[model samples]
Target: MGTAMTNPAVAALIARSHRLGADPRTTNYAGGNTSAKGAGTDPVTGEPVELLWVKGSGGDLGTLTENGLAVLRLDRLRALPGVYPGVEREDEMVAAFDYCLHGRGGAAPSIDTAMHGLVDVPHVDHLHPDAGIAIATAADGPALTEEIFGDRVLWVDWRRPGFQLGLDIAAVQRANPQAIGVILGGHGITAWGATSDECEANSQEIIGIAARYIADKGKEAPFGPRIIKNLDKTVRRTKAADLFPIIRGLASTDRPQVGHFTDDDVVLDFVGSERLKELAALGTSCPDHFLRTKVKPLVLDTAPDAPLDEVTTRLKELHEAYRADYRAYYDRHATPDSPAIRGADPAIVLVPGIGMFSFGANKQTARVAGEFYVNAINVMRGAEAISRYAPIDEAEKFRIEYWSLEEAKLQRMPKPKPLSTRVAFVTGGGSGIGRAIALRLAAEGACVVVADRDAATAETVAREIGGTDAAISVTADVTDAAAVEAAVNEAVLAFGGVDLIVNNAGLSISKPLLETTEQDWDLQHDVMAKGSFLVAKAAARILIAQGMGGDIVYISSKNSLFAGPDNVAYGAAKADQAHQVRLLAAELGAFGVRVNGINPDGVVRGSGIFAGGWGAQRAAVYGVPEERLGEFYAQRTLLKREVLPEHVANAVFVLTAGDLSHTTGLHIPVDAGVAAAFLR
Candidate 1:
């Protein structure tokens, strides 16, 4: 270890923490904390004092910055245990930590601050490693640790994290002065050393020891093959797509946001195991997981070739039962003095014969929950391979779940955006109205599927919004049924399910009835009329299956209602689309799928139709220069302002964002107050 000064010591600690947190095997998404004690001059007194710079609550160590570390006066933190009473010590400890802030600009200290302060060494690292937790949760964890490392490690019994836990660590250290680390039963491992490098090295060494031990034990006693004789053939991704939204609807408090589901190889393997029910009944291996995954997962039965409607009905029943069981669990554990907490709904769901599903307020949280559950599955398998898996008792779980300190971390999080967790599919999303709508939706936190006939443009637009999680690009001709189906599958694969569909793909043709050839008529009608039908049909299947409400917005034109000269084919096709939206609204209303249309006029800039020489042709018909055509149209409107693509996009947002939740089967004119195009 280098002979670094006090400031360098904290820097070294931060760097090392980032390295470990970046690896999922070491720590999954803000689940771990690290601290380093160093000498610093007090801002108020200008006197030298010891300070503990610990990872703050709700901060992700993987991407930690200096501001993410909470600095507290070590002397005050260390003195708290001596003065604290036995009752409500956790709350008292948090209050003390708040009072001891060294300079005050950083986030609140982590709940484990006292434990970090109590360690005698200069540097300390705490992490819930998958391998370490696997060993820690095994019934024979202490015995196994002793056999593996002899006296180099000390074992601590299960205790909820807070003031008492800090005292226990100090006691263990006193007994095992020469120990390099402590193995926390039913929790995690902690290591400390004189230098940051040494501390991290020790942490990794302990994890490596646990990993090898688990591997060897698994080889010695391999689990039997996971055989489910009557298990349905794995559900197809397309069919499984519909199941999550229904789950979201049931799980939500008021309005349902989208739910993201995953069924990777690991998830499928775990769910397919014959012992799935038994293993899942066992609690989560680590306490931190309880924040996201809860004590147990909801398991649903499935069958081969099950119809979507049947699966939806079954899920609704299971969800109701799950909520009842959660309420009962809370009632059993709640004390008269205890504050009422939210129901203990399962964060992760296991659908036998299909795979696992995780729910969150948004896509990011859902994905995080999925990641933690996957890690839990691996840890449980490893622990059982060595010995019977054992996790913290139910009482301990309740304490951690309801811990005021832990709940505060979530409460501190920023409010979600209006469309957070909603997924939208926008056809012709590469440019003009489609692109604007896609970007706008993404800005409001919706995961957008940018579907366009132009592959390159679709990809560019998707990248512009944000990669993968925010938007995904799919190339498909909406008029082609197979292509439309494929595009829908792409959206489901990327974002679980679709909550909004924007039918915005179209072209303009300025030809009189006599001049309009069959080819021209078919091209306009196929894209405007047939294309809308195909996309709507494909999306309707999913929306109906989801059973949660959804929105379908059609991008028609004012010409559809008030036909312009020499625009017969374009007008007729758009009219057909508008009529189709009304018919669809009539049929799909019972399923909570709202269908509506927006009739926009004179949105010439950036329009693909205008770029195809239609602008010049229309200008010639009106006896004006092509550049002045937009001005001419603007003057025609009562408002005398240009109707832009962004205006149309905003209108789309209003309709899809539940602003028009009570209104459907109607047309909204977005034409800058044009009397001719106004709806009567």
Candidate 2:
């Protein structure tokens, strides 16, 4: 990467790719591939040779780095056609591409490598822009190309992407010397230039012209007349919130799946349109869209204004039907060597008045799948207005979806983390022990909900964990039952449902029996005791409904056992939390929901409790400086070590994940060794 970036042509290609990818008009996320050919020094022969640098398989042009591009000798690539076994054996060519390496080659060459390499151009851009696809999927796309850009933008008939399609494109380029680009039938666009700038300009011109053509000449209602009016924004979102968990559960029948819901104006319009079922059944045209969105979306026939109970019943029936149809679709096209049926669950589900719900192994995949469908919608709109919206047939789609090359790519991906499919909800995650727990769980590959009463700090912690895919922040007062219920709902909507719950939200009121007012006891009890119970009760509904086993961990204190001075109210509340763990464990054991607790001595550093004046109060009682309390506490422990929040976080992880699956109703002490606080 370091040496390659120094080459001027390689640099120009990367810069151009970034610009094109950044705009949705040019390409969807990771939708297209771009390439440039340049001179490279042969290490052994000390001779200058032409090299091809193309965006490799599974890379996004917008965020491409030098390493993301594959390097190959142009001479070897151009020579492959001499021994071509034809389109039937084109998949083998992807393997042959390795032999044309300029050096160690870089990332693996994409399926589109031949298009860039065999086409006699210095720079090339192959894209799947919505506007370009709009025309490509049109029945008269070739005529439209002639009508709009004349011969300057040539047209290539539909051909599945392979060495043959590459050769087809190469032929088009060679024949039309004045043509800047070719509109690929039932796919997207490919443009080449004498230089990087010219190629980019050519691409933008084609997309802009197609977009304007559709805007001016296209019909107003491309999807046909609207059949159902949309519900109000609040009702729409509420419906989505209600259905998300149930849909997630149904979607996870084969394997656990995270989901994303989108009800934007575009999606709403499409779902409520008369052609919703027809267009969705036709599926997506572009390889990028089809690969992400599956063969076709599952379209719900229920009206938008149906009752929730009726909708749920009908949805279940529709879901089973979709799965059966998908299974049959696979059987119709599968061969002895075809990749094993991955799953029958539809990736994208379209519901009128509600929205689209897309599922995948993770949130990012689900979100991207949803976005690809939106692009497909735009393509459908334009194609319908100008000509018939024709996508590749089912047989062609099956060939691409189960392509052996794609299966190999999946096999090469690294194994997922232990908690990759799980989601964690951490209370009081804005600061202290909860924050540490949230960060730790996320690191282990769990999507996290950082819930705190303070919205700002919760947001800050969520940002630290990563983007919306990995974490989201929710503000709720746990003592209020409704707030606790709403907070759990947020987790369900953001992720699929809660797989783990860490009841760590609490503050302390330290005072001796004489000075402790009734208010002190009630406040501590309300937060630590009642809050934990409310959170557990609310989350249990989701976990049980998911029908997947889950975990609930309570963060108790050593004071729950030890009779520490000036800590009666705090100790009693901690004791209450500790017992709830056992109680829930016994009650929920039959459901496969493990309940556990971690009892830790005061973790002063990063402690939200300590920062809220508890540190000064405790220090005064113990005759030490507030900052020195940690050192004093460390000296008093049997291990002579101060307890840290991370220690408790580790204990929580151990109890919930991996080897400890069967163990439940257990309490692990994270106090470094405080004999007085130890369980008898």
Candidate 3:
């Protein structure tokens, strides 16, 4: 086939990487692999998937699949690299590869096994692309890289392909414990980690750092050295110093790269050069360099005697023009299906004899620009013999520049509707609290599967919301572990993922401790406690396997904290549920699952529980008019308002949404004054 496989998860991952500010071209073409075991062949048999994952032969990594990847055995492939005759003989090599896999009894792996095997960490990555090769293959690459990375990186010149490269990397990593990633000259970079997502993150971070270094540290063009000597008129040096940090910040906050070039002569001369106009006309920097520097730089070559208004006007004009050009470039290339690229960015500036300017959104982007400019200079100098290096097409550039899904990912702040598309399964979804939570989650756009012991009630609730088709209502007693598993499986099969789960299905009783029988305790615990565990366990597997983060919300009661007289069985069982939330949060956090409990006090407004307690008994407890109990609870301090199911629903929505993205492992009070009273 001419193209490679693409799947939603891979697309999402690529989107995430892009949002982190990685070049789509750099990260898009290559495939990625991840597994559960940190460092084993397989978690089950201890056999490795060699490469663990390989990009399909011709697939676009922008859209790849778990199945599209070729999982090979690394040890076997490393051994075979030397024995193999040529690419044409790969068929024969496949036989030997099968033999190695057969040793582990039908466990097949990737051909890049040896490459991945070399990484000491659990995750490994390898890619070959022109952007990476452009920098790696340069003669002064290592020295230039060393100037930027210093002792933080491991830089290796080109080596023989296959096993030798892997071996060299392993040797370097073993020799240098501080190296988190490797830059293979003329090939690509490799990042490792304790987990797959971490490994992917490490890869993005290293590339970003490298890109930034290039933008920040590379040389400008040759000219007069130092701004003071080039300026025709002198200004207060103290004022210049004062402007330094602010200028730096303004320059670097929005570009791919900005660096303070130390080669004073190069900076000043280039700023004053006659070719500045021509270069600016063509575009600021190259397309790849756009991330390093916005397409062009601001030029200031007028005499130091120029008016302050003149200087201001020049800077403004240059910035505005560059923004216009960027928009034009975007408009010319982007398609109807593609998203717009934000182009009001100024990446470079030239202050005539004063010096050159560069900027990135951060220090790293500045560094990336430095490296890019150095390469640009080299490319220009080399063009004296051949053609100036032409960049990839505008369409390709737009594809990288305007990728939408990637843009949606870079939120360092809290957001709402984080779990909007997430699927949640709630027990007891028919009436009372369970139905409230399910409807609330659905209002937040979660595809909710409501499971209840009563079939008719479940169906009725599912239908009332006009979600008959989309909202699944499964009739299964929470106490039946098998039924819970089946329902969870059905949800996964339908949704492809599960992100939020509300364990609100429960049975309550108010018998005194001595009066509670063995059957009553067993039945209550089985439904309220064990049932939650079963559903959580099944959903956790689906989430952890997918590597997509998930959240679990347990519906508990205030009685779980306050041991009231004559409610021993219900209190104890609910307490167990709360405890389970804590333990599950601890265990599942590593797998990216967040668990929390919602404890409600006297929230049984219209439920059967209210029917059992509403008469004189409720009146005695409140000591108020029977009809005024709502106002009594509402005015019992704090906000002084009766709690609505909607209020509890609102709490659930916030916890599951972007508002409380960082919270986990605790009980939140949906009960107004009761929880606060105990605390006080």
Which stretches of model 2 miss by more than 4 angstroms?
Answer: none
By summed lDDT, which 10 consecutive residues of candidate 1 come out lowest? 227-236
CA error at residue 492 for candidate 1, angstroms = 2.3
What ranking of all candidate models by TM-score puts the best one first?
Answer: 2, 1, 3
- lDDT tens digits, residues 227-294, model 2? 98888988887777777777787888888888888888999999999989988999987888988899
- Please give the lDDT score for candidate 2: 0.91
Task: Residues 108-141, candidate 3: write the lDDT tens digits.
Answer: 3433444565566655655432334334544565
* Candidate 1 lDDT by residue in tens digits, 1-680: 11222387678977998899989878889888999999888767879989888898888989887878888889988888778787455567777888888875776787788789998889888899988888888898889889888899888888888877877887887788788888899989988888999999999999888888888767433235665433343445655656665666665644454456777777777777777878887769588787788788888776634777787778777878877887877787877755576655567888766677787777777778888898888788888888878998887788778777666766777988778878899999999889999999999889999999999999999999986768889999988999998899778756667889999998878877899899999999999899999999999987876667789999998988886888889999999999998999999999989999999987889787787788988998788999998899899988898888899999988998766789889899998887877787
Report, for every candidate in turn, its global Cα lDDT versus the true structure: 0.82, 0.91, 0.57
lDDT of model 3, residue 677: 31
User: Between prediction 1 and prediction 2, which has the larger lDDT?
Assistant: 2
> How do all models score by TM-score?
0.94, 0.96, 0.40
Candidate 3 Cα lDDT to native: 0.57
The best candidate by lDDT is: 2
* CA RMSD (A), model 1: 3.0
